[model samples]
Target: MNPHNPNRHNLGTVISFEFRRTVLKPKFWLISLSVPLLIGVVVGLIALSGQTTAQRVESQDTASVTFTYTDASGLIDPTVARTAGGTPVSDAAAARAAVVAGTSQCHIDYPKDPLSQPIDVQGKDLGLFDSSRYNAVATTVFTTSIEHKIGNPTLAKLAVNPPDVQLATFADGHATAGIAGVIAPGIFLVLFYMAVLMLGNQMLNVTLEEKENRVTEMILTTMNPTTLIVGKVLALVGIGIVQGLVVGIPASIVFGLLSGSMGLPEASAGVPTLGSIPIDAGAVAIGFCLFLFSFLMFTGLLVAIGAVMPSAKEAGNTFGVVVMSMFIPLYAGSLLVSDPHGVVSQIFTFFPLTAPVSTLLRNATGGLYWWEAAIALAILAVCGWVFLMVGVRLFRTGSISYGSRVKIGRALGWTTGR
Candidate 1:
């Protein structure tokens, strides 16, 4: 067998060993299965709560509410009151008597100066009335009456029938994409966040565990440190892919069901639901590539850090910086949402640690230039290679030094003897 090729048999053995050890662990199964299950349960509860609320509102609106009112100012004619969906009573005494006798659901008293003084409302069950609808109707009646009295026909006409302003953006005289432009990016961002958080922490813990338990020494004796690291990293990537599918598929189904049951459009009028948002296959492919490369780069850095630490606790203490770098995009999420092409977003796109999320967001939002994305990906690939080489060197040299923690500068100074 050639020294480099080292028999495909050996590499397979290493990969199989790592894969089985990881996949069969109870912790792995727990995390992979629980996340999607929890998300589905929560979404179901929320949908049920919303449905219950809607039923209550519909029931309330359908119930008849006979309202009697006395207009002391005489501005409100009996016709106007009737048209406004209220029964006109002859006097305040009549309105009050009707309400108290349960003949009417509510009584309204319009003051002498209806505009200047507050309107007094008495109801047997205040909750039964939709205050918003009643307030709107009362406002229209008072404003119309005042305008009529003032003799401003134009103002009255404008008040009664406001100009319908349908705002639209034209791309070469055609309407551009609607709410999906805003929403699709948000969905991509969330998915990217979940993937990185779950996979990155797993990488960190796995790498640190080998160092903490002194297993690196035993493994290094049989396999090249670089080979051992590569095999483990590949195994973890496989695990991550499985875990992502496990969580994402069920969550997506649940989200779709929730959106449909709630009468959410697949992307027309209001908040865009998952089914409604149009996904660009090409953009998604590019985003996946970026995510993959970024994950490798982050895992490499974590593995390098773990190799230098004396124990898992120490590695964790220093892992905060790496975690913070991964989440820098989250901290600047507002800037990305408000102005994806702004200076802040540009900085994030170019910076390796923040590039994955920033590029995905800009791509999803249709703000990323082709050249910018190409450059970002190139930078990420290079950084990932450098990190992998550095991690291999650190693990090779520092694995035997268990007396104290290895400084990063010293670890970087060490080189593989080719």
Candidate 2:
């Protein structure tokens, strides 16, 4: 490997050119900045209206209502009803009629056999969710009356409303954040998918652009097809990183500020924290490898699709199918989590397109064994290299033909020249 190899120099030149050409475009900046700007605007509005909105909600929830109840079980204490914003009324029929006529907000009828029969609640409909307040008021009054009868307020209160629970699980004799600790490795998986989604179309266009512009011949004359294709794929990845940074940095800052303003606790008992999350060095290393090779395999696939099809429109149909294949594991996410070693999960873990996501998912869930990760990584690395080679062959054949689709047989040297 000579330091000044001509092909290496050409590859660098190609990468530099493609990256700058895409990055410097006004449309690139517009698309990249639009999401963060929209998020910022929304956050600003929420921050400004937070106090007013809280006050409005509190006022609505505590608003007085003309409520009446008929207690056939003799459990309705008049004092409790009045305190809970309800009135005890005789003649259930008259109370129901008042509610229907909008003179009263609600009417509750406690059955004679209270233990066996349901309480009948009739109310003026106040829209779907809000109408539930009627039942809430009636229940509160009945519960308070029961507490009074028990004559032990503290014990009754404890029985009625239990204290908040915080659960902690032990792993290998050490306390861990449970699900969050297990799924932490999946962050790499998420970043890989994000990069692919952002750059998949770019990968499709990179190989096809030269053909579309009818300059493939001139470009091919200066650089080998392998160098050019690899260079363009690398550039597409570079572009994805740039987009991720532009979006992730501002979003992170806004999230930090919003979390502080919202009074989120840094180490809540149930919530997972950075220090609490368990980290396995081997798993993290394998996860990063999975991310890298998976992305390369997908990029190669899209580039090959672009090289084979004559135009972007024609290529996009194939591109969509390929992208959808990657999500096959996600559709079976429940099975993956519940039974990662099952036949279906095993199929996805080994299959080329779905392997990256599947392996990563199982890795995060602590279901994928180290050996399985190795096998999946090996498959992805091989497929990625094969796809790149296939793309190079296709580019050589398809780029020479303008406005016509290149048959796979001819592209791969199975048939006569195109």
Candidate 3:
């Protein structure tokens, strides 16, 4: 293999090796498969329990629950209890006797003014009745009796059909969509953050592992450092994509099922569901570009940091810093959600470190102008390229220079031969 033209074969070999080491490992498969399966099992059991409970509730609802009542008020007509599907006993003792004899499940003693004076309600098992329905029935009995005594039966009829007010909400001059609009983007942000962190950590660990085990020195004999770094990063990118699909597809399906089960509206008049949010091909393309380049920029920094660190422990500290930087945008998430195009949001969108999350958030919430997205992507692409070049320089210089730790300033100086 020619030294200058050896990238093709060498790149393939490195990718293949790294892929097997990380993506194709037994643990990766176990975690990827087990998590979703466990979630599904747990959810299924909960749903089954809920269904059993609902069936029990429905059966109780259907069973006749006779109420024995003493109308001490003298205003309540015995026909009212008969009409309401209840038996009216002459006195409280008779009512209790009826309950004991299994002739009635509940007993009510009405006062002269049921609304002003507290009514006595007793039952064998109060839990057997749907509380809300039982309350409504009791209220109806009292109100109807009062209305009949007052000679205003029409008022009682009107009370049963009260007026309702419908409510709607808007944000930024646009009507807020259903819960999907909020939930879908949130889900995207979380998934994106997890994928980036997981893959970035993996890349960092691989870089540090090679350095710690002296594997880089042996591999450096056959190929250029640039080729090795590029290949490994590319392999990690592939693994990230595959891992995303492995996790994302099932999660999406489950989310869709849950959304449907919960009776979330598909789409409002002008608002979009998760499925409908992109709205056009251009937005989709730009969003993908932002995610890809943003990922490259962060992973490149992780690789560079890993190359410079002398041990896994040191790499961990650097990894924590980078992870914390990613979370900075999350702290101001409410501001971004409320005002996607505000000053602070614009700063996050333009800043390379926070651009991916900020831009994606803006895109998901309302959207940014095409020009804004283009500018952000351009900035991210440049940052990613610069980081990649810096990582290559760091990897080349620091790969063999073990024993002493590599300082960032010295590494830059060495890259310039100063």
Candidate 4:
């Protein structure tokens, strides 16, 4: 390899060298090995937690409902005990006692023809309390109770179910499904942001290692810096995706099986009839693409950072700030649930550094319009291109650049050929 001869950029050769860079590194292999095992342990722990939650919800259902009512209150029937849905109470004291003791689901105590008194409701002639209705049971007892006693018979029927809000939401979906959908955005955001950190640092560390060892001169003879940096970023991005798939696929499979086997209490609660984990193939695809794109965007930036810094030490100092920037998306990601379509969120969705994650979050939250998603993807693609170009420029110049501590301003100037 002649140092003076200019190396022609060949995509194939550069990629070959990049693969070698990853595979030959002992520390890279060690990290790769640990990722799967750590992921498996985390998945197992989550499954265990889910099992406990299911058991807790199921156990709570056995506790009977207790009611409080007065038999002589006239609203309650003292002569005949009514089922939980009817006006059945012997006395106010007994009703209150049953309520306190948790022996009854509900109680209806009546006055001795209490409705005859100065109506407690004041000016209301409607029977908010009726004593005669208890003799013959209605087919729908609670419905009749509300319509005849508590609500206007002519107007819209109103049944203010007080217990419903307090009761454990046994899941036939309810509002819980909507709430769960909202969580998808934040989960995708944090996951993509985390993957970026891993891939970004991996790219930075590799570039710095080569620089520190003066291997750039050796590679420069065989490959141009532009081709070299591009190939390496591409290769590392692939590895990051492979890593994501390895972790995500197994976890998804395990979660599905566990969620099915360990039937959650509210799992069958509401409308959509959820029997298993809600993960669909679409979720897997979105997660996969998000993982890949996020890693690419962050890793490209790291490669550019690596090119400008002459030594590993200089790069490490800047890495603290870089790392913070990558992870800041996670903190901001939570807002996707509350304000998925808010002004601030929309702006971040369009911005380059934040778009990959913010856009992914919007998709997960069902906030994304088709055009917005397309635009964000386009922006990310352009940014990747720009980063690759900048990385090469910085690399070609900074390969021979020597200094005490490199500065960002100096790197920017160098990237622009200053």
By TM-score, highest first, what's the ranking? Answer: 2, 1, 3, 4
Give the better candidate number (2 or 3) by TM-score.
2
lDDT of each: 0.70, 0.80, 0.71, 0.57
What is the per-residue lDDT of model 3 for residues 1-418, given as tens digits with 9 covering 90 to 100?
5566567888899899988888767888777766566656675676677788788666654555567677777877667667776776667887778777876778878877765998777666555446434554565677777677667777766765666544455656766664456444444455567667667667686567778888887878888888888888888877766766676667656665555444345554565444433132344456556667777778788888788888878788878888887889888888987888889989998998888888877766655777888899899888877887788887777777676577676777744544
RMSD of each: 5.7, 3.8, 6.0, 10.8
Model 2 local distance difference test score: 0.80
Model 1 per-residue lDDT tens digits across residues 153-268? 78777866798655444445534445454443444456556766766655665456677676777776777777777777777767766776677677767766565665443443
Error of 4 at 353 (Å): 2.1
Give candidate 3's root-mean-square deviation (CA, Å): 6.0
**Per-residue lDDT over 234-342 for candidate 2, one digit per residue giving the tens place of the 0 to 100 score:** 8877887687668766754665556444433333354434443445556667877888789888988888888889999999999889979978889999999899999
Model 4 — TM-score against the truth?
Answer: 0.61
Backbone clashes, candidate 4: 25
Better of 1 and 3 by TM-score: 1
Residue-level error in angstroms, candidate 2, position 10: 0.7
Q: Which candidate is the best by lDDT?
A: 2
- Reference-based TM-score of each model: 0.75, 0.85, 0.71, 0.61
Candidate 2 weakest lDDT stretch, 10 residues = 263-272
